[model samples]
Target: QVFPAHGPGVKAPSLQDGQYVLQGVRALCLRANNTELVSGGSDGSLLCWDVTSGSLGRLVRTVQVWSN
Candidate 1:
């Protein structure tokens, strides 16, 4: 979960419906601007999030890195 480092009235990010159930998170990166996030999951999927939005829990983009 992303936590706002220091804000007077920023709300915590909330999850949206129909989101993926990640098996496990292998890697996580917060963008240099601190407005985006990228995560690689064990399911071979990469998810991108908009950290500036309230519904950051729902992925803005998803990509399958590999398939069996």
Candidate 2:
């Protein structure tokens, strides 16, 4: 599940772009002092996101770890 960058105490504004949401998310991790986010999908797709400002996440790169 997606969550606000600052934590649960702070409420986040709604997002408009569909791309802002990561689908089929199985696992997620934060790095680089929370500036970078990586999400692993059930479809064997790994998505790298930029969460620098925490306003909205931007899709940085996508990698297919495995495919049928």
Candidate 3:
């Protein structure tokens, strides 16, 4: 999902170095004025990612949702 910083409608070069891959995520939510991304998925893990480089940045906070 790389896009031009100036023209977001335009596609840009990927930042991936091919040494790593991000996986198992769903329902993306963006915040921090579009600089930060957040999502939770089937792994029952919620994570916030860096939008600029598309890397797993920091472990912001976590929550447990008990399934009945």
Candidate 4:
């Protein structure tokens, strides 16, 4: 769900990319100042983006989930 950076009132953009390789997103959040974004992918990966600079930051941390 790629939402507009302007505000929550605005609608998110349609998914133009292909199907999600992973099934679910465990968590998603944005900086209170709206200068950054974060999301956790099902494939045990975490992504952080710097909205103001339009660049991806380094991975702060990660957790591996093993299928039972």
Candidate 5:
């Protein structure tokens, strides 16, 4: 899941057809600056992404903190 850091250009994930299994992850934090997305997940890592590319979940970089 992703959330915008500030005003404007906020969007939600769309449902495709019926009974589709969606991905689950705990996002500890989120920040958006322009088209860039910085997210901290429960997997004990930080990821930078460009949300404008397709699913937009394209990871630009990764920083591992600690894993469970």
Candidate 6:
């Protein structure tokens, strides 16, 4: 589960029909400008997406193994 930086609670968006899924999410980090969200998932994948634009930004450069 991912949480906002403010620490209010975990941010879990329901997957409506057409929404993209960031599956197996393990860790989340904000981009340098704080306008985008980067998430590390259990599949050793990282995804970057823009918050305002609602568009995928870039793929993570490195793959990280997430241990359960």
lDDT of 1 by residue, 25-68 (tens): 66889979888788765555467777777344545445656657
Writing each residue's lDDT as its tens digit, candidate 2 over 1-64 gives 3555544332322133334343345678987677777866544555676786545354555566
| Best first by lDDT, ranked | 6, 4, 1, 3, 2, 5
Ten residues in a row with the worst lDDT in model 5? 9-18
Candidate 3 TM-score to native: 0.48
lDDT score at residue 47, model 6, on the 0-100 scale: 79
lDDT of 6 by residue, 1-68 (tens): 24555444433332333344444566888878989999776456577989888787786665545445
Error of 3 at 29 (Å): 0.3
Model 1 spans > 4 angstroms off: 1-22, 54-68
Clash totals in order: 0, 0, 0, 0, 0, 0
Whichever of 3 and 5 has more lDDT, that candidate is: 3
Of candidates 3 and 2, the better by TM-score: 3
Scored by lDDT, the top model is 6
lDDT of each: 0.57, 0.55, 0.56, 0.62, 0.45, 0.63
List the lowest-lDDT window of 10 residues for candidate 6.
9-18
> Model 6, stretches more than 4 Å misplaced?
1-22, 62-68
Candidate with more favorable, higher TM-score: 2 or 6 = 6
Model 5 pairs whose backbones collide: none
Give the TM-scores of the predictions, in the order they appear.
0.46, 0.43, 0.48, 0.52, 0.34, 0.52
Clashing pairs in 1: none
Native-vs-model 5 lDDT? 0.45
Model 5, runs deviating above 4 Å: 1-33, 54-68
Look at candidate 5 and tell me the lDDT of residue 29. 39
